[model samples]
Target chain A: MKVIEPHIHMIARTTHDYERMARMHTVACCEPAFWAGYDRTSARAFHDYFTHISQFEPKRAAQYHIQHYCWICINPKEANDLSLSREVISFIPEFLAAPTALGIGEIGLNLNTKNEMTIFEEQVELAVKYDQLIWIHTPHLKDKLKGTKMMLDYLKGHGKIKPERICFDHCEEHTIKMIRDAGFWAAMTIYPVTKNSPARVVDAIEIYGIDHMLVDASGDWGPSDPGTLHDAIFEMRKRGHKEPVIETVFYNNPCYFLGQCEKFRLTPDRPREEAWA
Target chain B: MNSFNKQAALTPPKNASELLDIYFLDIRSALLESAAALDRIERAAGGKDILDDPRIQDLKRACNIIMDGKNNRSEQILLLLSHPLE
Candidate 1:
């Protein structure tokens, strides 16, 4: 069972996460570009972080025999600090050219504030300008509903972007259908407290169907289970979702999504190193 | 600087938040510039009295889009990117 975690930030994660994830047949993983625990106040700092996540991690994952790809974008949460954000933005090109680099990701509103709104729009514009796919991160506050609507409206109005080319992440009960109906790729983060749990994700598939949908435990910072993709897949099967559907969300859907990014490749023809294990 | 460039930096800034204070700050300038365009239009075209009018509304609409990021992931990243509570 080859599973693809379309979103995960392994830099803030521990080595144990890789061990656990590698054991589960995680064929490929996408880490949305985000702030690590460390604070970076300069372009030089961003250069280092980019290399760590976009370069070092992929090599590290190769050791574990898992394909690692990462997204490039500032998260919605950090929009207020206008200074460093610009420097970070300047460094994105260095990573985008990397073979393991995907697209601008995990970009969306968080608190739904003025800063968040500004950065999200610019990032969407960047993705469009680069002809890159997006992986968005919705809010965690009550404003999530507001953020979700704001994100969808902004994307549709951009005139250069297609919803199919962007993914809305951390979708909730109130906003999931609207995300799908708007014609964008829809995703849910399976963390313990925020977003959907595996059980809830299973229910989401029951309603939203498997097309253009992907799920993962995009946990970074708070208490989270990096193995949530495995949990969701196994639990969905236990919950009576057809085995094939479970496989589709866990494997096929993500492969299809990453395929949109020329940087990511999940070939079904060859046997992966893990397949031998 | 320009609306297109303001739109340009979002992807890279968010991808490398902790180290990119300059990126967000730069975006802030672009956003405020758009906001200035709206402010100017609001003034030249009359106050909020006629604000609902469509012509000035176009600039304001573009301003609103960039302002929206003040509430997004990059904003939250600032929280993480900021000085620790300690």
Candidate 2:
């Protein structure tokens, strides 16, 4: 079955990870701008980061027959530096036009700080202006619930924001309900350490069902592995989920969201409503 | 469709006895890796009592959840280890 990894940091990974993903039938992967294990010094650094993901990563993934797509934004972790963020956001529009660039993404609060929210709001405006799809990164661990709520409430009240066009990733059991209930997509990220495991992700799928759900490995520089996504697929198989159900979560759901951008090429095998049925 | 109206489309999984037949080796490998890690931790502690450490306590709690035979063991163990408020 074909898989679509909707959230990962490929700049921090090597070609071997790409090869592994290709072998596992990952037809396409999306890399949202993320923390590169440390804070970058200036907007110029973010420019280079954005350029690499947009200009370079696509070529790298094409060698393995995997379509590479990216999102542009000043990530939440670095959003605290307002001057640097403004500088980064200033150039985001140019990259947003790139063929592989999906939209403003992985953009949300890092610490639920006022500065982060301000930048997040600014980026939301940017996305709306450009008619781009959005991908979000909710804060980790203890701050997640409040951080998710904070973004949800803001977007819900924004009047112009369309929940269907946005995705809030790294959702857990506690946060999944609110995200889905709000008509936004909820993505569970599997990690080898320090986040949702494959089993836990599968459990959420079992409990919450698969509508508007996405699963990603979130492989990065930290202790994470791309295989976690395949592990979740395997977990579902072992639990006796039908192939169509697995396809809906791991493949079709991502296509439905990311495909909102004309740049994303994959189409769902079945209509979303039929898959849900 | 929302969580309230949809459920995972799944048939019952293989019985535990049948599952063991297919996954025995994988289970054994995981247990062996855990045991090896615990052995290394104990040796590195140099006889100092670190059993009461919070990390170890969490591991123990996780193990208890594993043995509880609940269908949602993964969710229970994850909640025990996660920082999110349940």
Candidate 3:
């Protein structure tokens, strides 16, 4: 039942949710760089927002006994506002040393915005400078396919950037293989309306094997959950997945990514419960 | 809770997918109360701190609204996270 949720946004989550996940045996969380845009206005506004993600959110998650670490980046949808993007970027370095601040992430393109590309590139450079991992976000709508390819194109040419130090998010049927082939971890966000489901996530693991697969709820401003990661694992078990394979996808792969954190702790193996045992 | 919204007799949440729309808005309401209590404490402590007192005022104005909004949204998230969209 051990798990490591790779893309939860604790800023939108409550402490009770964290306690439930911790007691359910969640080991760690690798939150991607995300926007708390429910009401954020300017770059100065997002400056405080990033600090909350890097500082307050993890502290709250810890109170529930779960290790919560996050990536820092301005999302592509906000790229059109260069002022906010620039301000958020400047604030990222200050959060690098926080025990739970994993990397520069959740950065990528939307609708082929040249402005988004610029923001993504600058953040990527920041990621490289701090020697932290990159958490990339592919577009979620009609332009996703094109945006995915463009994001990969940008990463491919960087001489000092290794593809292995990255996690590509919002991956679906179309983008999964491409991101995997490029040597990045694939994180499937399980949302009811837009992203993959608990069932689909399990199916993806069945097809991809446990090498570098991770799942999360992407619990942002949308209808999402901080506990869905655990629910996905349970659904996988009910669907006939072996406990060993389930544990690896839920715990092992996510920990592998968040292990990049300076404060990572070793996860221990536990026996799975059987109905008749 | 009404019958349509109340799945009180429904099967237990065997998985995340099963918990959708079946709220413990009951739980959300309770948590919101405690969060409100904390805000009152913060405002009390910070009395007259900004622009003669704007920071404290903003904190108070923000308190009740954020509590209600977060709880309502938490329910939406609980449903969305548990189930998959076609």
**Top model number, DockQ:** 2
Better of 1 and 3 by lDDT: 1
Better of 2 and 3 by TM-score: 2
C-alpha local distance difference test of each model: 0.70, 0.86, 0.69
Candidate DockQ scores, in order: 0.01, 0.26, 0.02
Which pairs of residues have clashing backbones in candidate 2?
A: none
lDDT of 1 by residue, A1-277 (tens): 7888888888877777787888999878888887666555666766777788888889877877889998887766667777667666766766788888888877787677787788777777777777888888887745677777777887777777777678888876567767777777778888885567776676566655666677888868778877878888776655444555566668877766678777677853322222111
Per-residue lDDT tens digits of candidate 2, residues A18-52? 99999999999999998887899878888899999
- TM-score of every prediction relative to native: 0.72, 0.84, 0.71
Provide the DockQ value for model 1.
0.01
lDDT of 2 by residue, B1-86 (tens): 22334445344466768767867898799889998988888888463477778889898888888887477676566467555543
Highest lDDT against the true fold, candidate: 2
Candidate 1 residue A170 Cα shift, in angstroms, is 0.4
Q: Would candidate 2 be rated incorrect, acceptable, medium or high by CAPRI criteria? A: acceptable
Instruction: DockQ winner between 1 and 2, please give it.
Output: 2
